[model samples]
Target chain A: MHLERLDFRLQLRALIRKELQQILRDRQLIFLLFAMPILQLFIYGFALSPEVDRLRLGIVDHAGSSISRALAASLVVNGVFEVEESGGTEAQLARKVQDGQLDAGLIIPADLERRYRSGQKTRVQVLIDGVDANTAGIASGYVGQILAAFNRQLTTGTQLPGELVAPQITFAYNPGLISSWFFVPGVIALVLNLVSTLVSSAALVREKDSGTLEQLLMTPVSSLQILLAKIVPLSFLLMITVFVALMVAFLVFHVPFRGNLLLFLFVSFLAILVGISIGIALAAYSENQRQSLLTSFFVNLPVIQLSGAIAPLESMPEIFQWMSLLNPLRYYVSCVRAIILKGVGLEEIWPNVLALAAYALILLSLSSSRFRKQLK
Target chain B: MRRVFSQVTKEIAQFRRDRLTLALAFFLPFVALLLYGYATRLESKNIPVAVKSYDTGTLSRAYIDTLFATNQLVPARFRGSDIMGPLDEGEAKAAIIIPAQFSREVAQGRVADIQVVIDASDVNNARVIKNCVIAAGNYFARSRDIARGRQLIVPQVRLWFNPGRDEALYVAPGAIAVILWIFPCLLAALAMSREKEQGTILQLYVSSITSFELVLGKALAYTLIALAQAVLLIAASMALFGLRLVGDPFMFVLSLVVFLASSVLFGTFAGTRASTQSAAVQLVATTGFTTALLLSGFLYPLRNITYPLSLISNILPARYFVEECRNAFVRGADFASQLYIPLALSSCALFLYLVTSNILRKMQLKG
Candidate 1:
């Protein structure tokens, strides 16, 4: 009996060692796995952004008054805005904004001269498409701020000649618009999902590919125990890798070290388990390494979509909101954010802990059952 | 259990020479974190425009000159006399006219008017222009009235959540999920794809292994890896970005489980359909990426889109993830309120498992 246990351990260890060798041997995969994420991070920092700047501007003035002309000049002269188009009907202008051809349009009424002469405030409507709330919202705000400044100019009227107008305004979190701060942390969350899943999924599947899975199965070991052993090494290895990644993210990216590391570690511990179990389950399910990788990719979409990493959760319909509950990434993001930003303890993040643990349980239990069924 | 250990050792021994497999297992997380951190963002930039000013006086000159000075547009140079010509020729956004009498009228305390002609070709750009104008004009008028001793003018405006109007502020929170979601899912989906490419899938099927076992094994292995990577990524993010999470971590993890399931299901399901590993990877990755970005309410919110289109967003998992993450991290909502998301996800996972297992079983026999 003791000899049997020793033999079992020997076999399991051998498999782990073999698995490690296979991964290390694939230089292309290692490069792809690591290089791809870093490249993507750079792209994200450079390209995809909600910030709208340098809008094409169009102006139409009918008053023919010196005042009308002067005003048009001031509108575009502001560094914050740019002059693009100059002539068209309101209907025609509306069509331009509708077609996605232009970002902003300006109309100076024909009676613009009359409004100023009669001293009656001319009401000019600024229209905006609410489709892209982010861009639309920003454009609208910029226009408002600039206009408020202009109001001050007009208050010192030509006739009245000497009063300043100022509007009350306030700025919120990330007042300076530092894109790095916003993206660095987000990238940390995104990168881990790819790294952990990719590596873990390939491990067990490789065993099956190498003609070792059946050999292991033939042994007298229970399927569940075999599965548990399979997860142990990979789990241990991944935990260390994650720590390295985190260290890189901090040391290399200089992202921000505001949150409590202890809270983060606790959450990381639970989240890592869930991720590892998912990988194990995939390995158990896959007949080949290719299948395991492909399976992981196929599942990427729904996870990202339901997680609210890119879009507003409330903005999405209620149904989709319910669907996202399954994405472990959402919870990871939440936990990461809490640890990084709030530096909260387990009590504060317990809900996330429980959720991650539950997810790990589900993945582990199901995979184990599947393994048992496979054994049968 | 003793036999199991022996088997594990044997499995480990059979592949000691394969270094590629081991390298990916531990090093992939850092790579993924760095890539996703840099790839995602809103695509919008530099618009071109032409300007024509009709006004000759100081005020009109000030206005038209201001238009040219705006950085958002690439300004076209023109004389005041050519205002209409530039506009008609489609060379300018709008031609501004300042009556020869503009300055005198304002000095005399009379209402002075200005007309702006806009090109309606680009609807959105036109609106942006209009917004800029009304805003600029109101400012000019407010102070002008005070100087002339005319009726005081006060305009009341209402603002929403982002008073500073920073678009990134709103995007920052959402981007966390939008960019991060792809990791677990894409990784899970790819795991099986890679195994198929390596010719390992066939060997696993010949054994007495059930489809459920196969799927579970794949899912668990990948999940473990994903969790580790997530930890590192999270740590990196917190250390570098200072992004705070005010909500429950449990809720966040719960959401991730659903995301992983959907990602793997697609891969597993796609594998059943595709004949080759490359084909599976291409098909699954494309579908996953497109669906999440376009339909999952990431770039565009359902509420802002057409109702019918919004309805389509319902079937997408990203939609819920976005909301749930926001609720979990931002609002700190309780587990009960969040229960609905997990319930829906679990059901989906179950459905995927059933379908995948059935198909795999069929494929195992036929292939």
Candidate 2:
């Protein structure tokens, strides 16, 4: 058997050309690669609003007086609660909440107004559905605010024999709590991670499964050449898709790019490298396309979960917090949020930037070595 | 019956060969549940705050102490005239400013202003901090009111089904249902599509067994495997997260069987529609799991969502199953109370089975 010397430039070019041809021919996948980001961007953008408005509130007003009616009106005044039914029993309200008709319900004592008139301590009950705990917690907070405001009004122009500590609130960065400001950067990182991983892994795993890798092996092209060919076009395609996703974030969500454009692009390039490496590594590990896809799903979700996009890292257990340090998505999310929201530069976000670079380098080398071993 | 039995043995044999797929089906849920269990918690406790106290009097100190007592906000480092500086730098999420007149104003029964500067870049955290600040102020006022022989209007918040609002308790049950739905569906979704891509479908056509037999055999094998996965997940949930079967044991198991059967059937249905194994894989990963996660009202309340979107959630079988699981495990609901969801799930499963079997038969006849 005679072995010819490897020609790096010629072999890589041919392999890349072949991969690009395959990508272009697979119209369904190309469409999926582009369309999935835009679809998810719109779906998550509109669907995921943290600002809880118009909660269904059932009122049980046993007081039956002007004061009680005024309290109920105050609850419904700010478009926070649309009054479902007034003057219902607590049992009726519980039934309504249990049956999914009302998200929450309020019960007023029979002597609420009388107690207010007589200068005695009184209480009002707010029952929240605990099924969706996040919404329930927020709704409970809103109820607190509503009641505090009512308490002030209830004692207005009258003397209260105690210290009244008034709290003045000031919100920075986003005063109105526009959820899009929070979601846009997160969606960008998530979309880039997803599209790049799926496309890159599918690219290589398809070749391996279809016996095309054997055809490439018949040539002088080495395993390294084949791996580069697989990653390069997908990385370039990922860059274009990410650029389009950033355009959506800017135009549709109106999230401004506050930091240096070059810095942002450089950081995105690092993130895309991380994504492609995971994809290639997952592809190298699996025998076929089905295995690769399932393995990638297992890998991607944990990366996102530990990334602190949806929840704060501080809130998580100490061990998961440590585990998040290894997650490339965590640094990507942190850097993007800092650049867009805080308008911080490289000096402020160098650690995260370095982390992304380190992750890309480490993951790329590991996956390349694994791919070479699989080739053997 | 013998044909079906042989098919089951063949599937189990194939399943044994692929240790990776077997490990994924058996164990990915445990990892996913652990990650999501810690990751999806929305409660913002131990949030750092900066205190700029212009009033070092006893009243001001007491007020700051009251804020700390909630255990929601902890004091962090802050040094600057502008409170926004530290907040923008991410040193602290909130800052409290106690005015010099705090002691005097409170002593005279006058309204005293204590400013809380919140970084609202994270809206959820901001809202939680704002509420905590308000509650702290109210507690201070109510304590003083009781001392001064004054009346206070106390507000009681009662949370049903989940009293203490433990995040793990809320996430575990839903995570189990999602795990049961996703893993088996993925494995079964691939069975038919893999055969098509590998030309085994042609081999099946040349054989004497009918397409109904093939589809039925595949479904039965996977249904058994999924049932095993269900048991593993339930045990994991209980052992790891302290999830208990508060309702009838038989009813919960029944619900689990129904949900598992329907999910695998749905996967089989998706397989028939897909032309390639990759497409079916994508269907399981992106479409099936995402539909179950987002549309099932697992994380968010369905009632709060508006008309058309709410209507769309009704069509997803996972929605009913998640509700059923929560009802059985958390609410301790009985069979009589939860009859409708099981019936609905069974109908969906039967519908998908009939559709998939028909498609398989049609493909066989054409071949």
Candidate 3:
């Protein structure tokens, strides 16, 4: 028994050493493992503030009056839209739109000042490209509302001003609509995937590269032992990577962690293991590095959509939502967001935990079988 | 003409024998559609909500009852809890905290504001729930006043963009980007991987097929495919949806050319690096499919990330394509000109080609 235990320990240690040597040897693997994540974190966190502001607009004031210029000035003062150039003809504004030089344009018709003086209703045409419907929609409506509100204040009509005014709009949750809240959690899930999915495939490719894979088969190490040895070390490395990532998110990105740290760790562990196992299983059949990377893409591409990381599951048509159930990342990401951001405990997050655990066990076992079969 | 025809026929026969290629070519679009349809919907309906009622009085009870009557909540998954559990688990989007003094405040004709604690993790979901919560509150106010024979609440002007919300104009340009990313990868994946399979890729070094020639030939093939796919996709989208060609098609195609050039160049790099068909497929999915969808600011905006990472998105050809396509097709951007996305994409294509050539020259036959 003592000899067997020692033998097992030696095998496990040897397998881990082999995996590490292969990963460290390759410069590309090093970049994928370390540089990519760090670069993305810094680049995405600092530079990419999705808070939509500073829209560039081209304006053509047909009347060329003080009122229109004053209106344009209010838009700039609000910091919502910037007038890149002050004066442009109607055709020039049209040209700007065509040239992609402008996000929007304001064309004040010939009689804007006259219309305001006559106390008559005037319609301002806001032309927008329907492509990128969301941005266009938001910009056009915001400009329209702001201008109309300015108009409303000036013209107190037959209907009382207060009556025409709607109840004040209060955006809850993210009142300012900070896009980071949407991106950060999704990125955390994705970055974790980089560790499990990307690394597992690379690790398998490394074994294939170094020729230790066939050598291991020549030895008496159980396929399951080899699989566990390969996974546990990588999982440890990934856990450290994930922890560091979370910390960066916490400190630098200001991504809040409201739940139990230990529970979060446990849940993330299960999720990462499942991803690694799936990658390992896929990697087992690959004959070369190219094949393994291809496996990673085919497997990982579907996961992004299937995981409810972007789309709300319920909103998806029934066939698609059912398809989402197969995505283990969906459960893991849900659990991560719940625990880390929302501070939900095991009681609420248990469903995801159970699903993830099941996934991990199934995937690891399947990968072990594939490894055994491949070796044979 | 006959020799060229026979060569083309031979290529066709070669393609027919490779079941993987056939299967992928046929099934990829269907797969993409299903994936996009299921994965990318931003709309949130049937948002789950948990209601904790501390209100037992008639007015408060009426409000609670009206809340249940609202459309936004999926159903009460949990009965009552303080702010944490349900929202934390995403079991409920909003927790309506109806306080004990609720009826008394209403009877006194004073404004009683019940706090609605929402899980703000999902901004869009939270927005929908907030709308529902407001509506429920308004319903309570209207009902309470109606009982006393008073007109308490009235509808008001909500200045929305385009006046009427149009969904068609929104999805067209993204489709153009999607086509640009996929078509080139398919054609380029085949060209490089095929050469590797046939042992002819090595002949580039033997013969004088410059690295530029290889990239250009492979890219030219895929560019044709991307162009064809663009026409079909654009025509189809416009036909299915009333997507008018408000902008210049020429500008759209020009931007697409830049996008495809970059994507095809990437495929060449990927195909060369890959030792097998599966790896080529995987590389496309990872670099082409995944990055194009997410990092390119297509499905989600690049601005959502921190600076330098979002800048990395600039290298993603689809980012430029999405921007330029949206400008031309939906925004009615002039076809004759537009510089930014095209310039960026051309630079990226040039860079990728240079890297492809450099790497190709240094290519090792074995990994």
Interface RMSD of each: 15.7, 2.9, 6.7
Q: Which ten residues in a row have the lowest lDDT in candidate 1 chain A?
A: A164-173
| Number of the top-ranking candidate, with DockQ as the measure | 2
Which digits, one per residue and each the tens of the lDDT, describe model 1 over residues B37-139? 3222232123334444344557655544444444544556543354444443334554455566666665565666655554432223444454555554544
Candidate 2 collision pairs: none
CAPRI quality level assigned to candidate 3 from its DockQ score:
acceptable
lDDT of 2 by residue, A20-94 (tens): 889978976686578878866765665556566688889998888897888888888988788887336888788
TM-score of each: 0.51, 0.91, 0.77
Candidates by TM-score, descending order: 2, 3, 1
Judge the docking of candidate 1 as incorrect, acceptable, medium or high: incorrect
User: What TM value does model 3 have?
Assistant: 0.77
Cα lDDT of model 2 by residue, B28-125, tens digit: 87788788766677667789999988886798888889989977789898855687766756778898888998988888778898887887767777
DockQ of every model listed? Answer: 0.03, 0.51, 0.24
True contacts kept of 3: 0.29
What value does DockQ give for candidate 1?
A: 0.03
